[model samples]
Target: MERCIDGVCSGIFGSAVFSDTVMQERLPKPIYKKLKKTIKEGLPLDPEVAEVVACVMKDWAVEIGATHFTHWFQPLTGVTAEKHDSFLTPTGDGKAIMEFSGKELIKGEPDASSFPSGGLRATFEARGYTAWDCTSPAFVKDKTLYIPTAFCSYNGEALDLKTPLLRSMEALSKQAIRILRLFGDTTTKRVVTTLGPEQEYFLVDKELFMKRKDLIYTGRTLFGAKPPKGQELEDHYFGILKEKVSRFMHDLDEELWKLGVSAKTKHNEVAPAQHELAPMFATTNIATDHNQLTMEIMKKVADRHGLACLLHEKPFAGVNGSGKHNNWSISTDDGRNLLDPGTTPLDNAQFLIFLVAVIKAVDEYADLLRFSVATAGNDHRLGANEAPPAIMSIFLGDELTSVIEQIETGVVKNNGTSRTLEIGVSTLPVLPKDNTDRNRTSPFAFTGNKFEFRSVGSSQSIATPNFIINTIVAEALSQIADRLENAGDFRAEVNAVVKEIISKHKRIIFNGNNYSEEWVAEAERRGLPNLRTTVDAIPALIAEKNIRVLEKHGVLNRAEIYSRYEICLENYIKTIRIEALTMIEMASRQILPATLSYVRKVADTVASLRAADADYSCVKEELDELVTLTSGLKAAIDKLDQKIKEADASEGDSLSHARAYKDVIIPQMNELRAVADRLETIVDASLWPIPTYGDLLFGV
Candidate 1:
């Protein structure tokens, strides 16, 4: 399945993208400057500029073999959506010409009722608008001009994740820029949030994948016995890639490069059949869009290599799962990273201000932050091996923790554990980004310059987590800016503010193992939120404090917030319901039937041995084990089916329904899976009914 992409060239990186370079090369200078202004400053796009830009963009797309165009947008379904239309328009003289108009480029209407709106759009109110978001680039994908856009309902309520995400960005920028001005930084225009999300996934043979109905229906194995050799040897982490995997990664990188995605780092992850890909940073919205594209393209590229890419948070049991580390930072328009703590007093104070602001933000809104990454798939991954716990805490490493403590207690103390590197000449001894060793077990760890939110699941959109991040941090920065905007001595106020924040919110900072039971008790003692699952976390979305912050920043309206809460509850209920049904089907229709056939064979052998008067004790023992398991399997299936009936019969409110699924159905489903997985160990390999963990994890 190796693909030989011919005619590789120097210009292949963004060949398909209508990027800034492409825009600059093809557009009139005046038009290009105006468009850049619109993109940077969040100004309205002028009709004349849009017309000219549309003309140039169409020309470039046509040159690259585009025949149709789509208003590509991200909806609340946690995925991207697009509808294509031909560029050809008929003439009165029975001839047609290809054209793209400014009106067309700026706006499109897709059916509102079709997308998940969380009741924002009624079924009969089938109108929604997709407005062009000039911030993210357009690219030619699959012979179509894919224009990135923001979707909204006819009433102007945000219907897609992109709209709220963009709003949160603007909110953060407005507050952050105000803080920059107080630092006497008049040259900086905009302060934008950047994200460098690392993606992790599993690659299994497509043929083997198709054999497992559980994987196909639920995106995770419902019943997998522990493999004889899992990732226990620790040999798979950073191991040499298989030949087929190497070719897949090579083609994947090239395809992503053509689409202007900066897929930077690729390596074997901690589990067998598991891998990770990290990208260079981009603006938050663009990075969100790029991540969606990356997930889509990963599946396509995997299929081409005869592999099935598993992006489920817990695709396999008894081994490491996948997570997307959300690396977040802020930067000024003129290229100064706001998070970088430099040597000078002004820079260090500024960095600490933003740093404590994040600490304060995460502390006050830890529950909401926990809620943002909540989903059914992630429930299995969180608090498990290779994934952080459900509790929200920050890891600042020893060096930075000491710096915060000195600011807090005014008594300098250091832990003996130390490592030093010259990142920059810092008034406080500087440590390079590498010196602060990565805390893989920490849920929210501050890397050298950015906060890596590690709770995000691999298959998630990242829009919710990032929007919540931007909104909460914006609230924190807004308060800090208000405190300092009128200060007579701004530098003096900065230190006081940072110290005050550390005193109050430093409880959120913990540089210890988040996975330990001791840490769980410690987190409870500190009153930190330990939202264990999506069902436990969803109610935080509608909490008055969370709603107030979201509203204050205009990231989401009250109605939108409630809609999201309802949506979260429904999504959780539906996901578990589907998983429950899938388990029933696999156990009843496949596993039990297959196992029974084997049981019947054993019974016949035992009977023949007894009739022959040969020693039948061993044969009787085997038959007894098979009979007991078959009876248990049938009873477990019946128990699961009855619970599903009760859940359906009493399905009332969304929250209650979700609880039914989570409390009753999920446990019963697990009970069934336990018996089935045990049966797998005893049954013949060919009679096990489906692929085992050994086949799925190592067959490739």
Candidate 2:
């Protein structure tokens, strides 16, 4: 394993990865320098340079016991997709030589029709290309060398998350550098976005997890009565870890660390058996890759520890669900945190401009942000007390809000000093979250520098949300740069823009409780769109303004946008359909049969009591109650089955089909679950077909 040097991160951090340290150690100096320059400047790798890097990378991977290589890419299916190829090349003899070429390293073709292309290609097209993303590092896992790549169609349409994400990063950097030049910072080069997504999950005993068919089919529990004690006492949060859970975490961290993922923090979450792991910040695209790898490693480690890790947003009902809080920020290559309120006059002026750009961007394109995190699993979690509300609002905290207010009113008042956050104000105080009452309820909150997008679901890939953030913020900065670059008095114009931005976009900056009903009502009054569901949020991707901005910034073309829009709806429609089918199957095969068996036993007891000439009223009453619930359960199953069949048969567009699932099918699923959960409480433990919520949550 690599170790830290001089107290700075070096080989110890990304030891297993084909990281910079390994490249420097192995590659010839000229080739290494050329490769690094190309990556840093976001330029295509020269063929000769790629040839050398590929050979060195292959040797490193082979040395690490990697026999096969995979082009690891994120498809539109909201998960990663990869196609593995062996490194062995036949040498015309019985034996073969391990060989990998620059062409193989730079690109590969896979069957495009199988993955969700969202009509970007025909079913018979069967061709997709994976281009090597030289920016993100390669790593070896399970004897397979996984090279990070950007997937696209043969026609060059982005069919994967990383492609658009890379485009957005470049788009943002282009505009940000323009902004930086206006501020007279020419040596900054590239402005890179960073992300640190905190992942939350639940770990259950593997046996208990397998017993529940719903947990097996869907990631969440379809039907389980609430356990008596939940997160109400808040004792589980940050509490002492159980020995088994601790062992799992330890193993998880080790695995993730070897893969070069910065699995920084681990602790108990609000719910029983729930835990969270947060990583240190990394380049946005690399962070997304690390997050996906982290989630995959988490499950593998848990299974080795005799546990099953649940990444579903709402794995259990009536408890705190999981969320992936994306902490995002941007900084210059020369090491300047753009969001930080710097002490010097020049620094303060630049920070104020960038800060206002984010404020204006969030206000103008809140819909895109919401749509970024939209998912069928997340629907059950959002707007709940445990997670941030569905409404898109920013929490700037009280002190920051005060600074913005002073800027808005043109009053420079601060603790017996004429300090202000307004641009062009030479004397300013660097007060970073001194009085920030952090609001967990806010969807997007400013925690000192970075904005934590708390609405992202745990199971989701962070690429989509981050790309949206990058594009929107880039658009805002582009608009500001147009004014600043052309203005005769740049500083005065910067101050004016900052003031106008805060004044106009102040509605997005809320320092109050976001979970309150008043906040919802006030959000509506402030003309904010409350897109509360995945279906409701999906259309925002294709909205006119969103499309315009995305095109203007060259992040995603209209066709690419429409394709993703189709995919999102399709994903939602399929997810609900699968869940509904799973419910119908569970109720009919498992819950109903077991329930009826218990009902028969109860009826037998009633008959015995009556025959014995004893008071039969109590036993008879129990039998009657059982029968009633059993009837309701049967009826609920039939209704869900019918609705699913109808949805499958009668579909106009994916949107309407998705609405049928959301509006009609989801309500019926709840109705079915209610009756089935009630039966779990009354039925005998031994007679029950599956493990109860208590067992799944606490048995671990």
Candidate 3:
């Protein structure tokens, strides 16, 4: 692999991608124009044009050393899936020729029974279709051409995340265009939600990762003692990267760039072993695909450098956990960001309407927003003082917050003039991009031109959260458009609508600290829903209001919404069950035996001191404490084992199972961990079976 320096790397970017530029060069003029129109305008793809484009795409992929092809889709399993097939077809002469057709490129068949369907499909009805999503470009990787697609059942039910996301995008575009037309903007045909998801992960030594059964089985450490120096001083944030980690990041960027992923920013995170990678914004669908690729490439690159990339939300306790900051914004087809608050946003009615639409949407569908990022792994991070709380709120900076206040009060207050900082030194240049102080603790923060959704889990897919955002905002925009379309006075109607939204939904906008207990109480008093766990939040998916919004926007039907609710609950239950089982195994086979051996050693030391006629008080005290800890450890282990057995025996629906796991089994697991962690503190490091927090955090 050849390395290109930063300045000379522009040419290498998108080299392996079948991008629009490559399509234009390789495809005929008419075919390229038709395909681009289909992609941009969301029109039906012409089969004749697809055939020509497919042949050209095949030639380009083969030239780049691709021998096989696959329709890559994101299923409901929260990860990507693909099935590869060689491009070879048998000839009459016993040889083979490489060939690809428009039909094959446009469709794929994968077994549906193998995936989680939430009762949408039975085992006998094992049929699913993968249709090519032409909007997201194809790319070549590992001698294969990967075409992005959306998966669905034979009956047309969405079996994957991409289908609903695409539907939501179209819904949002339609409503946004209506609003734009009302504002006298006719040239813009579509509105696209753009996203820049900042990925955070931890890289630990491969040797250490392999030794921990908890990490290997559950993707998180079920049990580990806290390190002495665990981000306490906060020195690791933005610190210089070590040579080994830097090499891994370099290779990761190169691989991502080849696939046309805009890998832009890299830096150390607050945790010692954690790091963050942020890309430039792209359309929502493409950004989702690129982010998935970035995460896969991050692990693959780390493996080559003899490391294990941990994307689990709470890979370690007593430190900052990882989160994917979804910086999302909306833009017009002609390149105008709707969220851009120009010099005098108070006077910009168009921007104000769009802003209030978001506020109303977030306030109305706060439960849906909460459930979008809910997962068993994320439950450990949320409200843990490191990541955002489970409660959903918006953080419009001081300027926007004040604007909303004025609208609510029906008083136009002048916002103060922008001020520039003057340093004492003459040579220092003034900063340019400083508009408002950033709020890291806010879950959904409006930072200058975009709202950063900070509640998304690192390991989870961004497709669900983005789709929810699109659908809710579309509903709000639709309501505004309906009122304005009938109003006799356009300007008066616009002000009335904006003021009404501000008055009703202003409670969701909180500029104060979201991590504080005071805010939690205040939010409860304000009638905001705080869903603190995956199980608690998952039920909101099938709420009457939520289903109505989704169905009205054509994003998802009622059946699909119920199916997803079941799937989420089932997934959460399975995840916690696996973690509990892994904890049981580690405690029974590793921790208990090691603690017993240490107790024997301590007893021996005390005996020797007494035999020598010396004061054995210290040694005797140590042995007594060891005995007490061992007793507590054994009792907790037995209790956890009993609870696991009870949970396994209890048979019920997915919701009941999940509730049992959360309400009954989790408390027992926590008790076991408490005792085991205490034992780890007293036991010898050499006897401990798994890697300690210090080694995993600092060894890299």
Candidate 4:
């Protein structure tokens, strides 16, 4: 119940987490030091040390009134999964005693077949293991000790998102260290990728949400007419929060804070009913875990306040969709942000090298970057005016772009010194943080010290995107290190590498509007791959170059790569299939019937008016329009049904099947929606079966 408005609430923050502070306080010094070493250095945990740590963890959990423990992990389903076991062990005398073992703490067995393995494991091959991820702290949730873990199959293939993510983080760190050594940074042992995921979502009344079958079934309004008043006036952005929403957010922050999630900022988003929560940055692994927990907590807290949190990328059309802006940066264990362009960026050779490496990675592997954010839900949001385009591009602000330009050409020009902004009134203070204007349209934008990846879907786990980024950048860094380590002159070699990278990858940098058609044509001219849909983008995962880089870094082997490709395609097809079926059911059962009733009422009114011997021209015209719309709706429904049947019966590989859904079935569905939405505009509000967009959007 503690609130953190301006000052820190010392004891309330991380109250439920088994954090490093908790370990230092509760655990013996030697055991705590050993465990810290294992966590920081990635060394194998000593059995004796684990036994002592497990005992202390169990005691702490029991002290906090937890009777059960669970190994929480992130699976391919894009959510956290766990199986709980009680602490009580039955003694021979029929009495129970609390017990926990090092073996149990270190590993767990979960059924792998039940989860999506995508040909990695057969139905009968159900074995999977969850090993403790010691770096991320455990926490108490719902009277259970939740230990973060990494999931894998019996043959050691990654069956969950966390396994590959952890591997990719290691890969990035190893290569980044090598690059740092080339820069004479021997004091730094590891370089870790850090992330701050800004989550955007919508809150709707729970009662209204339940009434909408599409929202319940698909997490979006599959068919709804655009409301008269949307975000057209741009009044919702940064507006004052409503009382109910403020209460929900306060509760949400408290819940997240208990689990050690640094929920820092909350504000209204660009869309009605839409809001955003931004957390402080953490190491990539812990940040991913905290984000997953934050999302779950958001929904749970909303429910308590009689609301449903909608995390879909586009829950409503004609307004802004939600996105998780991944603020990503790299740092060393010894406290240095690699992407930090200090006061004089031109003098910071290390920062320039790292920045160029990111640019090169994003340019060369644009397809892979596109694939990471590809999903059926996101397909509707990307390339729209509200969201970034499907084309991958980076936006380095004026200062860095000028630096890069100087590096590309052999001319170093002083791009004017930073100046303070003055207010017209002398009483007002000057602002200092306005070094550069922000471009929200860019997919990847440099925001001062870090890059913000704005194309990630709201509901995504963020693990895949960060890992893909880590792996690609690691490859670029590895290539740079290879040249530098063998060079006769380190400084000269660094400059040569930076220049070559800038020359090759400068096309990916654009400060203009990405949503413009001209940019699309320009990107095509520059030979940038524009994978516009989930179907178009997912194929990049299996491309030879992508596979080679991933395998070379040991992030994913060939089989693992293929499995993920299959899984992504399968998930896309299934999502579309479910959405199509839901649309068909709603169109035929709810919308068609409702419109037919309204049409019958209109026809009856027209007949009665004609029989009354009065002027019935307006009534007749309304009747004619209703009849035409109803007929059009019927025809659209038939066409959609036929297309769905054809898609269901089509035979091909996963990619081909997905193509059919995307190319043929989706168009048919859009046709059906057009007719249904028109019907909604004409039909009476009482006759409409489901909640309309306005009600769902503004009712909360």
Candidate 5:
């Protein structure tokens, strides 16, 4: 296969091909220019030009040896889906023509009923539409042209994350344009939120992974005792990558690059067997597409190296779980980062306004922000020592916090360290990286110029969270614009609005550790809702305020919002139910049998000793203890089975059922797991039915 080996990008994954020059070559100049204009200016795409662009795209893809095509989209199931079709047509009696039409390139019909549309689609209603998103260009991989698209139902309801995310992007741009005009930024016709989602995951040997049915079926080890050599040593994070792992990463990067995903950074993460991949920033829509592709390719490429990529947030207990830190920021068309504070504080009032808007948005909608990341997999990860807590708190560096505080209090405390700019020389002093302290524990943290949303699950699409982020910020900016547009004095009005927001919602800003028990209590005392589980968080998705905000901005209608709520809750319940059932199956078939076999060995030893010396008290005692423990394990398994049955029997709406799963079913599962784990340590290795945590974690 031909490859573009660029020395500049040799060490980086995204540096090789997706450079501006390559994009220009791939697209016709006129089409490319218009596409850029549309991407930058939020301009409408002309269908005529779309056809021409489609022709160019087909030719380029064919040149790249793409014989098939698929509309790649992110469904609410938190994974990507695609149906590929060969781009060949019969011309006459035995002659075949390689062809693809513009209409075919633009749209696709996938069965909606098969996908989890919450309650949006009925069993008989199977029609769903996938519209081509031109902003994210078509990329070729493995002899197929992959067109990034947004999935929606036939009734025009959003059935997937990408559609609402795209709408949110447009909503943000519209509101941001209004704010920009107020700041005299007429040249900047559009604004876009850029995202760089850093993905963390674990890679285990595929052979070992296949041995554990829990890992194979549930994407997690439903029953594994803690390894003696876990992350307590703290030696794995940022440690040198293993040779095998490095080789896997290298192959993964090459595959990702070929598909036009800019996988930028690869590193060892905190937990053992955990690793991270960071990508370069792009428009939110394209970033979402690239992230979905990155995840899919990560697994596919890992398989090539005999590795199983585990994206589960808490695949294992008693260790750090994976999360996707969504680094988000707003930018303008003219290569200007709205989040970047300019040299002069007075001259960068425009920037400060945008920054304040993000702060306020995070503050006002903190629960919804937290809800965006709510999932069963993530519930196990969040509030754990390594990951951020469930409570939504913003971490501005100390400098920015102080600046905002000063503005709020009308106290300019930087009264002495003043530098003067000379007329004939450069005297601009270096500004410190002060904003707020880096609170790793905070769910929402400001890292330099962008906000790092740390609560998102490793396996999540990142599209939904960004969608919420953009919409909330857009709402805040719209309100800010409304005040500034009518005010007599712009600076005074901007400062007042910023101060009012900070003063009113300053409680949302927490520079301290969010993982602490004290912080959880404090957050409650301060009136912040700590949505501890998915059941608690899913309702916030359809809260009246959330519904109003989403509908008002044209991001999602009432039906779409309600559908997502139902879908998310149902997904959570179903996931836990599956885990429960898997645990029950493992316990009955594997664990119980293994324990009984071990018990039999102990009993045989006792009998042989008694036969040899008729007074073997120790052997009898050991045999009795083994029998008791085995009986206990059997009882626990039966109890878990009963609870699972009870949960299965009770029925209500998704939310009520999800609560029962969390409150009733998960406890029983845990009880069964505890007894099984204890038995694992006591049983002989040869007699054990499944792989242990020590084997799964350190095997590679």
Candidate 6:
């Protein structure tokens, strides 16, 4: 509980511990300088220096009460993984000595068989290696020294998300450096992609959350009757947080801050019980690590406050679902924002080149980029009215659009009129207007200085999407750099490349409403991809163009890409299959029994009334209608169960199986839900085993 100049408790890792004590005191000055160079300039990690750093890391961790150390790596499971080992060795005299070697610190062995390898490794091939990622510093969590690392298979195939992500970042920096040299920016040695993913989640009271089997099993409500009031009033969005939720957020931020995560913003989201937390931007790799930690810490901190955090993309139906908006941009090592267009357009050609590269990248690789964010849980959220559509379009606001349009037609935008900023009182400050307005509906919208990838799911690992972004942008930059290098006049070539990209890929740009029907029709006419679901998008993962680009840049090998495609399909199918099973169980065990119990009570009431008086026909008629509806519901539940069993029995390629789950099994389950939901409305609440949507949504 230490505090920096900010006054809030520094949580665990104080700034003093981080800067002066841990880094400055631990490493020799030359080694420290070299390590920082590797981190900043995207250089290779020297094994000899890594060993020296590891010894220092172990001593610091042990001093902080750490008995074990773990190589923390992010796998394809969309979560972080670690294998812990104690730093104790037995002596001959029944004594033990604490020991953590440099080799032990730099490497780890985890069984590759159990993890979702997507056929990267077979059951018999259980070997996997975790190499310490020197760029991201090691830190202690829960008494374990957590060394951030990249995981790979024994045969050198990338098995984890972070490895390819790091590779793609390197690729981007290399290509971007070439452009920077061309622009005569010699001081900037490296370009890095940075991300600040805003995570949105729903927090429900623990007791209420536990009451619903759907929420417990699926991490989202598979079925629930509509609440009387939802976010319809829009009162919940950005409303003051309740005391309980506020305490949870406060504690959550403190915990995250301790781990070096810049948990900067927290507020209520568009839905009741939904909230968002945004961090300051960091290097994409560190940001990925921090995001995984943030998600884990969010759940742990919520438990401390007697709540359960729901990271499911569509935890509730008929409401705005949670999404992680990835605000991504690039920067030079010398502290220049590459995407920022300065006030004067004529002097901002460098920014224009980078901006056009991003636009061209999104246009050329839109399908692969879209596939990055595709997941089963996200499938429920994407393309809904609340979220951006699957069609990829760049929303550059009015000013930028006019600039690009003028460039395309070779006309001077704004008619060469520079309006003077004058204040009436001659004392007030005046400023130039910004070039573009923000568009929320476009999947990849260009804001002032960054592209906001709005389609990333709240529960996603961010690594994949960022990797895709880096690789695609690298490809575009490579193309631009090649053209400039070959051209006789560098300035003419730069403008020609910009104009050529804008003209050829201009169809990818759309300033109109992305959610409109007209936009969809226009996208189709423009020959843009509209990959709507995981089923549609997974196939694009292994397309020749995507494979060639990924392989060419060394981000992912052919085997690795194929493995990911298989993994995605399998995960999608498995997720739906589990949700289907959960639905059937809830319907059979909870809904049907509760409805029947209520129906029996009603029949008893009718019989008792008839015994007391003669006018019992009204009661009898009401009972009869209830009995018929319950019978229909019971039959639908049976049919749903049968269909799910049939789907389980069917077998084929992963994609075919996934389609079965989506088309055949899901519809049957929804039909059963429709009937059961109606019965919930008619049945007595006391008999219901599960909490209703109203209770879960509003209880917080």
CA lDDT of each candidate?
A: 0.88, 0.89, 0.88, 0.88, 0.81, 0.84
Estimate, for each residue in 1-700, the C-alpha lDDT of model 6 and write its tens digit: 1113254554443431233347777799988888888777767777777778777777787887888988899888888999888888898799998787778767888764688888888766768899887767677788888889999988888999999999999999999998888877777777888888999999998999888888888899988889889999999889999999999998887777777777888999999999999988877888898899999999999888889999999999999898999999998876567887754533377778898999999999999999999998888887887889999889887777767776666655354764422111112111223434467788888877888999999998999999999999999999899888788977677767888888999999998888888888999999999998889998998999999999999999999999999999988988887888888888888888888889899899998998998688987887887898888888887887788777778877888888988888878878878888878787888998798889888887
lDDT of 1 by residue, 259-341 (tens): 88888889999999999999888888889989999999999999999999999999988898899999999988765778888
TM-score of each: 0.96, 0.97, 0.95, 0.95, 0.94, 0.94
Deviation from truth (RMSD, Å), model 2:
2.0
Q: Any runs in candidate 3 off by more than 4 Å, and if so which?
A: 1-6, 343-347, 414-436
Report residue 290 deviation for candidate 2 (angstroms).
0.1
Q: Where in model 1 is the C-alpha error above 4 Å?
A: 1-10, 413-426
Show the colliding residue pairs in model 2: 2-12, 3-12
Give model 5's clash tally. Answer: 8
| Residue 317 CA displacement from its true place in model 1, Å | 0.6
Q: List candidate 4 segments past 4 Å from native.
A: 1-8, 343-347, 414-436
lDDT at 416 for candidate 4? 73
Q: What is the C-alpha RMSD of each candidate to the true structure, in Å?
A: 3.6, 2.0, 4.8, 4.8, 3.5, 4.1
| Of candidates 6 and 4, the better by lDDT | 4
Backbone clash pairs in model 4 (N, Cα, C under 3 Å; residues 3+ apart or in different chains), count: 0
- Say which prediction, candidate 3 or candidate 6, comes out ahead on lDDT: 3
What's the true lDDT of residue 76 in model 2?
Answer: 84
Q: How much lDDT does candidate 5 score?
A: 0.81
Give the Å error, residue 41, model 3: 0.8
Q: How well does candidate 6 match the true structure in TM-score terms? A: 0.94
lDDT of each residue in 1-700, candidate 2, tens digit only: 1222323344445667998888999999999999999988999989999898889999999998999999999998877888889999998878899988899899989775788888888766658999999999899999999999999898899999999899999999999999999888869789999888999999999988888778888899999999898888989999999999999988887788778887888999999999999988888998999999999999999999999999999999999999999999998876567888877888878888888899999999999999999999998888887787788989888777877888788777766876445556555555765344577788998888778899999999999999999999999999999999889988789889988998899999887888788988999999998999999999999999999999998889999999899999999988888888899998999999999999999999988988999898988888899999999999999988888889879849888889988989999999999999888889999999988888888898
Error of 6 at 200 (Å): 0.4
